[model samples]
Target: KGISADVINIHTIKPLDAEAIIKSVKKTGCVVTAEEHNFLGGLGESVARTLAENNPAPQEFVATQDTFGESGTPEQLFEKYGLNSEAILKAAEKVIKRK
Candidate 1:
């Protein structure tokens, strides 16, 4: 939480800002993309593809993996679908360690 942050708000999804995302990944050399949707065909995958094609960096996806959502409180849903901070951290670590 104390780390410096440079946030970029992407309001448009139909026409994603691939260049911006690619540039950000190039600068950081790592990325953690989070979304409420499923991992497949989601923003995380889009970011990963962009980075892969442009800069090829360590990218992590924090989203529901090939699963459907359940009706419950936000926290409950996250816990049930493994979309919590711990999962995100684990994904980041995995991506970073990938060869």
Candidate 2:
């Protein structure tokens, strides 16, 4: 496979890197956001908003669904919420299928 991936890190979400997001999504035709926060009103929302305004594409999110949290180690939380590398890979596979 000669596919190239376009990866961008938005460290500050107060002001999303919309230009970079649009540019990358335009090239890849899909997106997968992995965030360690609640899926609602998180980076996923910002990304959805950006795509809604600019270029929309099939997207998958690797984040915890909106719900109560329990005490656990970082690894446990990640494993429970499907935020690990396997989760990202699964999300990528899913989004690519939609494309």
Q: How do the residues 1-99 of candidate 1 rate in per-residue lDDT, one tens digit apiece? A: 222323456666658898788777666667877777898998877777777777887777778879766799999988878788788777666765662
In terms of TM-score, which candidate is strongest?
A: 2
Q: lDDT per residue, candidate 2, 1-99, as tens digits?
A: 334567788898888999999999988999999999899999988999999999989999888999788889999989998889889888888898898
Candidate 1: residue 54 Cα off by (Å): 1.4
TM-score of each: 0.77, 0.91
For model 1, the superposed segments whose C-alpha errors exceed 4 Å read 1-8
Q: Given candidate 1, what's the lDDT at residue 6?
A: 35
Worst 10 residues of 2 by lDDT: 1-10
Question: What's the CA error at residue 89 for candidate 2, in Å?
Answer: 0.5
- Candidate 1 worst ten-residue window by lDDT: 1-10
What lDDT does each candidate get?
0.74, 0.88
